[model samples]
Target: MGTWNEGAFDNDDASDFIDDLAEAPDWRTVIQMLDHVTKSAGYLEAPEGQMAVAAAAIVAAAVGDVAILPDDRRDLKAALGAPPQGAVALARSALARVVAPASELDELWQEGDDHDAWLTQIAALQTTLSASQ
Candidate 1:
């Protein structure tokens, strides 16, 4: 995980995921990424958690939570339009998984001095996602 900060798209995997979405902006891609994280049976890798965060951010943006998104990605709100209710639900689940036990992303961050900051960012995203529900 080439993470530089706590923002959703501030890492290599997340940036790559967003780039893929930009190429063919589809809601299914967002939901699929979220599902990948939520359905993982074992420890969730850092890269998967990163991408799931990015996907959840997109779902939040799609439902008018653009303020929770990075500036460059705010346009995705228009590109993605509105996500289905299921995607919104999945986004919340995916985010919970990203911060749950066995999540490499969470484990790694917990070892850092900025873990609280990262958790705050996730919480903000979750709050934004919840508002859309």
Candidate 2:
């Protein structure tokens, strides 16, 4: 498919993206999804825009090793607009289950982390996440 564009489809909402991230069997899949969403949202330059905000929150959550803590998730999702839709109690269910390989990020990504290197990292994490399963 072509690169993502806003309003490309009726159900191309952030929730679907979020669910994709949560259901990603491995981090490689997660990065693929993130890259698609981020590229579509113009890297969140439209910070308050719906899709960008959602992608930003998920990136922050991943960098911060987020779990589905209700309070924290509430703040993240609300920042985008509203709350989760499914079973209220399971709002953060998928996120809560994420077990990152290491501690929270201490610094933002920078140069040297080129596209190829970044994909390599994602591939490695794919192995890690898959192995963990």
What residue pairs are clashing in model 1? none
Number of the top candidate by lDDT? 1
lDDT string for model 2 (113-132, tens) is 44254334334434332333
Query: What lDDT score goes with residue 118 in model 2?
Result: 31
What local distance difference test score does each model get?
0.87, 0.31
- Which pairs, if any, clash in model 2? 68-96
* Steric clash count of candidate 2: 1
Off by over 4 Å in 2: 1-12, 37-52, 65-133
Report the lDDT tens digits of candidate 1 across residue range 20-47: 8988988888888888889998999999
Best by TM-score: 1
- lDDT for model 1, please: 0.87
User: For all the candidates, what are their Cα RMSDs to the real structure?
Assistant: 1.1, 14.3
